[model samples]
Target: MEIELVNCECCGLKEDCTQDYISEVKAKFDGKWLCGLCSEAVSDEVKRGKKSSFGMDEAVKAHMSFCGKFKSNPAVKVADGMRQMLRRRSGDLSSSSSKKFMRSAST
Candidate 1:
């Protein structure tokens, strides 16, 4: 199967995160998946006085659900190098975009 190099659903980084990390985080949070960078950014923004937000958890959950569909598939064990490749091409996922992604993902 072809793996999509989407932005990490945790941190808003446009990196191509592995399906494993994405799935793990997604399942842990009710299907809301944040890109790795976005996830950290949200936490950091919160620390920087940004107001609290919602729907992130849902995005993570979606990511998890998406991954779950692939569980037991060989793609789940994709190499770390592939993730690095995605990261290299990833863009800066803004908090706003993160929210949008989450909202769209949930719907």
Candidate 2:
């Protein structure tokens, strides 16, 4: 199978994938190619949209719009990722501390 470098429609992330794989991904995303992360985000959006009775096209458009906002600058994207990582780490630390506090209180 031949491999091709494909740019994601949402995040502009480039991935080397086989033509068959690329075709499969495009087929799943309403003919637009998305990277793995964007695809998962879109899939989640579709699930969330189901609760509001929105269709796949609307979900895709919403996700594309969200991604478009952040795709303009690489520095901004990196900073955003760092911010999210820090937030997750802080949350984990707080939860661990709370667990320790509970243990100490029980003892």
Candidate 1 regions with alpha-carbon error over 4 angstroms: 1-3, 8-13, 44-107
**Residue range 1-107, candidate 1, lDDT tens digits:** 33556654333335465678767766755565665444554445445543545354544444446545653422324445678767765644465678899999999
Candidate lDDT scores, in order, read: 0.53, 0.84
> Model 1 TM-score?
0.30
